[model samples]
Target chain A: MRQLIVFTLAILVSTTFKVYSQEIRIVNYDQLDKLVSSTKDSVVVVNFWATTCKPCLEELPYFAEAGKVNKNEPVKFLFVSMDFTSKKEKAAEVFSKYNLPGKCVLLSENPNNWINKFNPQWGGDIPYTFLQDKKGNRTHYPKTFATSEELINLIKKELIKQ
Target chain B: MKHLLAILFLFIVSISIAQTTGYKPGDKAIDFSLKNIDGKNVSLKNYNDAKGYIVVFTCNHCPYAKAYESRIEELNQKYASKGYPVIAINPNDPVAYPEDSYENMQKNAAEKHFTFPYLLDETQNVAKTYGALKTPHVYILKKVNNELIVKYVGAIDDNTESAKDVKKKYAENALNELLQDKTVKEPETKAIGCGIKWKKN
Candidate 1:
C-alpha cells in the first residue's frame, strides 16, 4: 500500500515537471533577427511580453493555442519577453510554471530604441503585438492582451492581406 | 500646403492650451522652479537661450528607470555639450513609493554620478503641468525661433529591460530631426513605467 502511494506521487511530480518545462527559451539578438528574416514570407506575429506584466501571462496561452492552430499555415509567432536581465531565471521559472509555447526570446536592449522603430509612437507598453503582411503593411496592435477570438481575427486579417 | 497650414494652426492652439491643460506638440513648455537635492533652486527660464531641453521624469526606485539610468546619463552628456541639457525630475510621492523619497533620490544620483540636476518636484506641480504619468517619461523641447516648442515626448528608448534586441532610438531620432529642422516622425509615445505615485487625493 505504501509502495503504491509513493509510486503515484512520483509519477504525478514527474508528469507535472515534464508538462511545464517546454514553454520558455532565451534567445539573443542574432537569433531574433534570424527568426524575423526567416519568416519574411509569412505574416509575422511578434508579441512583447514580461513576467511582471499580469496581462501578458494571462494572455500567453491563447497565443500558444493560436500557434498550434496555424502550424500548417505560413504564419509564424514570436514571443519576445521584456523581462529584465536580472530576472531571466525568474522569467524562465515562470515560463516553466505556465507552460508557455512558441519561440520565446528575452529582449536584451533598451526600451527607447525599439518603441519608435516598431511604431515611433509606442511607449514600450506590453503585451504589444506587431503584425505584418507580405505587402510590408505593418499594424501594431499594442494591447494588454487579446482574447482567442481577437487573436484569430487578427491572424485571419493578416493572412487575407497577404 | 493645406496640411501644413492645419498643422501650424493646431500647433498654435496646442501651445496655448498646454499652459493650462494637456501637453501637445509645438507647445511652449511652461517654466518650472523646483528644488534640487541640496535645496538649491532650478528653473527652465534660467536656460532661456538653450537650443533644447530634455525634461525626463524619473525616480530612484523604479526598475524601468534604473534600467535606463546609464543611457539617460549618456544622452545628457551627448546633448548637453550640444546645448540640449537634461533635467531629471523625481515626481513620485514619497509617501507611496518610499524609495523615491528625497534622501534616496540624492543617494541614487550620487551613486549613479548623474551630471544633470536631479530636481525634486516637492509639490509635483511640474509633473502635473507636463502630464508626466510615469517614471522614465521624457519630453524633448527645442527653442524654435526663440519659442519653446516641444519636439518630442515619450520613452527614452525601445527596450528598457534589455539592450540587446533594441530596434529604434526614439529620443535620439527626435533630437536629430530637430537639429536638421525636419518634422519629428514620431512625436509622442505612451509613457510606461511604475505609474506616478501621486499623493492620494
Candidate 2:
C-alpha cells in the first residue's frame, strides 16, 4: 500500500510538471485577435517578442514583474511570441524560465499578413507592445520598456482611465 | 500659462513625429560611402553600370536575418547580372550585439560565402537616412537619370517560415515589374524583424 501511494504521487508530480511546461499555446492571428479583443472588463497588454531579439529578451523580466504587480487589477497580460513554429520548444523554455504570469501563445503566422491589422503605423519592429483598455482604446509602443516601473505605470494609467 | 504649456507640448510632439518619418517610395535615396568587407569604401554612385540596387539592412545576430540570408544570396545571384546587385549593410550597434560587430560581420560574410558587397554602416547614418527600422529590411532602388529612385520598400516575401511555402514574392514581383519597365504594384510592405540596435543616446 505504501509503495503504491509513492508511485502514484511520483506520476502525479511528473504529469503536473509536464503540463506546466507545455502550457504555451500555439495560435494563429485570428485566435490571437479573439484572445486580445474578447476581454471586455480588463485591459489587454500584448507584447510581441522573440527569443532571438536581444532587447526583447532583456525586457521580458520587466513584463513578468509588471504582470505579478498587477495580478489583482483588471489587466490581462498576453505574451505573443513571434518565433517560428519550429522554435516553439525554445520559446516554451524561455516562457517557463521567466515563469511569466498570464497566458503565453506563439503566433505561428507570417507577420506580413497581419501586421497592418494590428497597427498600420507599426513598422514590424519586435519588442513592440500593444495596450488596449476596457473601452477599446489602444496604445502601441514600438520600443522596449526600460523598466518594470515604466510598464506598471502604463498599466495603472490605463486602468484608471474612463 | 496652461495654454502656453499646451502649445509647447504640441510643438514637441510635432518635432518628434517629423524625426521618425523616413523616406517613402519615389523619394530619391541618398548615396552612402560605407566601408565594405574588402576594406574599400562602396557607394551607390560607384555602380554606374548598375540599373538599380537591392539595398538590404541586415545583421549577423537576428534569427529573422539568418532565415533570410540564403534568399538574399539567391537574389544577388539572380539579379546581379541583370544590373540590380545586392548591397547588404550591417546597421546595428555592436555594443548592443557583439555578433553585429565589424569583425564578426566580416567573418560571417566569409563563412556564408556572401558574393555581394557586405558593408558596415559604422555611424548608422545610412540606416537613419533611409529610415530602416529593422534587419532584413529591403529598399529596392532604380536609377533614373543618375538618381536612385526608391521603387519598393518592404519584405523579401510574404512568408518568413519557409520560402517554398511563400504565396506572394513581394520583392521579386516588384523587381520583375521594374525590369519590364512597368510600375511596381506594391510600393511598400511590412514584416516582423529584429529592430536595428541604435547607439545609446
Candidate 3:
C-alpha cells in the first residue's frame, strides 16, 4: 500500500512538472475567441500583448504572479499575443522566459482588420486587457500596463458578482 | 505672484483650447518647428509652396510603420509636385526603444531614400497635443486661406499587412477630395500599430 501511494505521488509530480514546462499554443483570433468565450464558472482576464512591446513585456510578471496566487480560484488568466504568425517561435521564447501562467495564445491575424472587433474602445494598442465573468459580461481596460493588485481586485470583484 | 498666476492660468487655458478634439476635420492645425533629419528645423510655415501636408507619426522599429515607409515616400513623390508633401515624425522615446533613436532615424531615411522631411518630436509634445495614440498615425492637412486646416486623420490606408489588397486609401482619398474642392466622406480611420513609447517620468 505504501509503494502504491509513493507511485501515485510520483505520477502526480511528473504530470505537474510536465504541465509547468509545456510550450504555449499558437492560435488565431477565432480559435482564441472561442476558447475564451467557452470558459465557465471563472472570471476571465484576457491581456493583449506583443513580444516587441516593452510595457507589455514588463507587465507579464504581475499577471503571472496573480495567476500563481489564484491557482485554485475560479479565475482564468489568458495572454493573447499580438505577434505575427511567422514569429510564433520568438513569442514562445519570450513566454517561456517569463513562465507565464495559464494558457498563452498567439493571435496570427492582420491586426488592421481585427482591432475594432475585439472592442470598440480598443485603439489597436498593446497591453490592452479585458475582464469578464462566467456570464460573458466584460470590462475593458485599455491601458498600457496594470499591477498585480489591480488585476487581483478586478478578478475578486468579478468573482463576487458571480 | 499674482502676475505669475495670471500667466499660468492663461497658459493652461490656451493649451486646453488648442487641444480641442485634437485636429478634427475643419480644425486649424497647430504649426510646429521640429528638427529634421538634415539637421535643420522645418515647419508647416516653411512649406510655402505646399498645398497640403501628410503629417505622419511613425518610427523606425514598429512593423506597421516600416510597412508604410515606402508608401509614405511614394506619397511625397506622387503628390509633392502637386503641392502636397509628406512630413514624417518619430515620437517614440529612444530610452524605451533604442532602435528608434535619432541615429537610426537617419540610417533608415538614408536606406529608404526618403524624399520627405523625416522629423523628430524629441519631447513628444506634438504627438500628445495631436492626440496621436499609435505609431503610423496620419493627419492630412490642407492649406486654406493662409492657414493649415486638418482635413483627415487616421491610418494611411485600410490594410497594413498588404498594400496591394487594400480596398480603401483613407489618407490619399482625403487628399484627392480636398484637391477637388470637396469634403472628405470618410475623414477618420483606425489601424493596428505599436503604441507610442512614452518617456517614464
Report the error of model 1 at residue A147, Å.
24
lDDT of 1 by residue, B1-201 (tens): 999999999999987665434467777787788888878899877885578899999988777788889999999899888888999999988886778899998899899899999999988888888877667889998876666777788887677766665567889999888878799999976535755666757
Q: Which stretches of candidate 1 lie above 4 Å from their native place?
A: A1-82, A85-88, A91-162, B1-21
True contacts kept of each: 0.28, 0.86, 0.58
Among incorrect, acceptable, medium and high, the docking class of model 1 is incorrect
Order by lDDT, highest first: 2, 3, 1
lDDT, candidate 2, A1-162, per-residue tens: 999999999999999998875767898889998888888989999999888888998999998888889878899888988998888889888877886877789998767778888788888988899899998788989989888899999999999998
DockQ computed for model 3 against the true two-chain complex using alpha carbons: 0.42
Candidate 1 local distance difference test against the native = 0.77
**What DockQ does each listed candidate score?**
0.19, 0.72, 0.42
Model 2 segments more than 4 A misplaced: A1-21, B1-18
- A81-138: candidate 1 lDDT, tens digit per residue: 7777678777777765654445567876544444445465454545678787765567
Top TM-score model: 2
Worst 10 residues of 3 chain B by lDDT: B17-26
DockQ of 1: 0.19
Tell me each candidate's TM-score. 0.59, 0.91, 0.82
Error of 1 at B3 (Å): 35
